[model samples]
Target: MKRREFAALGLASLALPALAADAGFDGQVEAFLEALWRLDPDAAVAAGRFEFAPQITLPGSAQRDRQRAFLKHWLAEFENRSDATLSVSQRMDRAMLIAKINSDLWQLDTLREWAWNPANYNPAGPLDLLLNTDYAPLPERLKALKPRVAALPAFYRAAQASLAPNGGVTREHTELAIQQAPGVLGVLDDIAKRAAEAGQAATFKAPLAQARAAVNGYGAHLKRLLPSARRSFRIGAALYEAKFAHDIQSARTAKATYEIALQRREEVLAGMQAQAAALWPSVIGAEAPPADRFALIGRVIAKLSERHVARERFVDEIRAQIPQLEAWVRDHDLLNQDMSKPLAVRETPEYERGVAGASIEAPGPYRPQDKTYYNVTPLDELTPEQAESSLREYNHWILQILSIHEAIPGHYTQLVHANRVPGKVKALFGNGAMIEGWAVYGERMMIESGYGASPEMTLMWGKWHLRAVTNTLLDYSVHTGGMTEADALDLLMRQAFQTEREAREKWRRVQLTSVQLTSYFSGYSEIFVLREQLKAKSGPGGFDLKAFHEKFLGYGSAPVRLIAAEMIRS
Candidate 1:
């Protein structure tokens, strides 16, 4: 189908074979997936459906209505199916797809991020993937990118029309969009360079220029909206609760998780204090320990934080650490490590920054063979003070922890396992808590397994673990309870031992995002509890830690609670 024709197709009009009632569950799943890919081309491309590469779904009423109809139809179809008749895998996929449908519907009808978040309109991501990934030849990728690039003007216009007026647009989001606008320009510039390589520079010149101009215009539009952007970034209570449920899918409620995080905070603090007190003489030298416990812990952590790599070596340092982590996991006989998979630690792309400093950009299940990017935002972009603060925040020990979290047996390894799982749905629609929780869990698991086995390492891990606990507190309190910046900063810098730069960015992050910060602790806590329960049930030496890790991860990024149930049953 032509890009526009496919883009314009509603669920009802979608070309699907075996639409008859007797098509069976597999047929229905196939049909639903086909329609889904056509509707959301960005997801399609991510999942390695390059045929949809040229299409861009416009962000306006027409597309929203089409998506609403698409979600409702599939949701009903999946709902009608009896779980008893389906195979175990099919049942899991069906449940996941239904949940995904409902989540998409909620996002469209209730959340309506397109109307509020101008940053949602950027076409840089998919376009960049196509241009850079070598998923296909340059000429073909550029050829496919042309029409989408040509449609940029209309896309931005629709985005402008989609924004809700009279305080719907948040200043932070608008400002974020403006900051990221250059990223779109950067993508275009890169695309131009590639097009020149392909000897198709002349062909792409006009559209690329038009696309660049449109991006610039969008930035200008957001600049105008900034003055009038009165909507608070806080989603408030009701929205926060709903979003938390949808996104986290935790067994516990958001309020319950917040309480648990509060409790976890105290436990982590106690652990950190003990570790710090033990290491104080060595780390802090002749300095006297503070009478206050927190003050003492802070002093020790601050001293440790100062022992980071140079700003220039930051990204390379993360790269070099990956092999060491992999070797450690292998030597320790931790979870099964996939040695064949490629993990490339790179500088965070321009447009993808502003949310978190470091993250993993794993390929979708369809393209499992692609390199998983460990994106570390380089320190060159920061001011001297800011750079020093970041360096301190991700000091030698914590940087190793970060490496384990983002690479090795953390996200990259988990994702590799996820991609190899039986069902693509779970890999594609992964639970954020499960993914992040496993990373948090991995950090602790590594320390427990004797990687970086020192009081200093233990103490740093405690500080790192505390960061996850505090993230939940910060996110829940800020969104639901109206946490002010001062209190939040104090909670981070003083209590969690985060550097000032890290805390400030997190404050901005909490404003720009909702419910995400809670993932690490929420997932980690559930996974930890499940592991302990199983270990206790199995008696001494019966439960294998490696077995438990492998089994839990084998569920392919399903929620920790669901995985726990499966584990218990097994």
Candidate 2:
């Protein structure tokens, strides 16, 4: 039978309820999301719902209780409607919505990061979004921001009270909150300037000063709590496993994925060793190769890392490489590129910085037409030594790979496709693994297609690939296996061929996050496996790479396993 016919047969095999009488289900979905947006207005603003720009969900029990009730009621409503009640497309949407609701419920009830993670309370992002985005007239945007700014004092105060009742906050999270608290002042200052430009300074002056003081006071409060902030950052095995299931939604368990990553790490290391040996004479002069394979690979990577651009040219270099990447992907016919959707390369905002060096801030599904930002953290802020270390880590070849991952045909491209997807549910509640995995898979696809085809590029790509592999290892080991700082650093710097600066940052990142690090390897591996299986099924001549990609991404940002099942069935 044909694939679509097989998909129909497969759906028929499962006994399901009768279809809904009318379009009531669609209305329910719309109603559910509208309620969700109101309860979580900051998220709504980020998703391009400017109507919620002035709202702020205060951090306390009352708000949590309300959220809990909302989620419970919606969960029952959606659960009441069975798979047979929805159309094929609506089935996918319903499944995604249910998973999103369950994840939120688990987060609010089980994990409870809100009480322990002080970094959860920052107002910088939404405030900055309102101030910076040209979604409306400057005067109107400022007017909407007034209520949110006015609520800052109570927000921080409630944040303080939220922590006291929940035992102690995690020290790392507290430190991060302290580090990022002052950045809100920058947003407030920008608003002040913008308000003045629009001749509305007086309207904003009082709230602006009050917001700044609240931010400053919040920072000081965190500093005072630092010494006593003794809660461990590690969520341990159970929480990590649960979060992996909820956030990643992978087919395999965390332990199983970790084992696969371990095997994959050895394979990558062997490949890097081969490339390093081949380049030894040219890269390291006439000296004999080091007996230890890890040492040999590390030395070659270090030498090649010297070819990176200068500090001032770091961001400029990324911008320059984007067009080249897009051109290459176009010339090669890898995947469809949408040039009309603009991608902006900019410095990472201060508030968003402690997590990752580079990220994509795409316009939410509600505002898909707005510019998608490719944020790269600037090198100027780092000390001279720190700057050089980071530059080396990014280097020439790997820098291109980074661009492939974060921009063109990576996050920027995937997100654009996500925005165009028919339903807003998948776009809003995108699976982390699917989003991250596609980018990781993009890196491999570019390399295999010969974007940079030298042994040096091969070696660097191996090293870069190791970063994803080791990320899974580091996260799994630290959270579940009780991996020490020293062991984690050794895994990154020694085995993974990362620079000292990069290793330390990864170490810090693992503490701040959990399971998210594993998404790279888990998603990439699943996607790669699925592609190979499909290729075999389609036979060599029948398979089309570009078609496969477009079809795979066309399902929106659902979990890879779900996408796999759908694609394979079709």
Tens digit per residue, CA lDDT, model 2, 264-305: 988998888988999999999999999999999988999999
C-alpha lDDT of residue 371 in model 1: 80
lDDT of 2: 0.83
Error of 2 at 53 (Å): 1.6
> lDDT of each structure?
0.83, 0.83
What is the Cα-based TM-score of model 1?
0.95
lDDT of 1 at 38: 90
After TM-score superposition, the amount by which residue 462's alpha carbon in candidate 2 deviates from its true location, in angstroms, is 0.8
Query: lDDT score, residue 465, model 2?
Result: 88
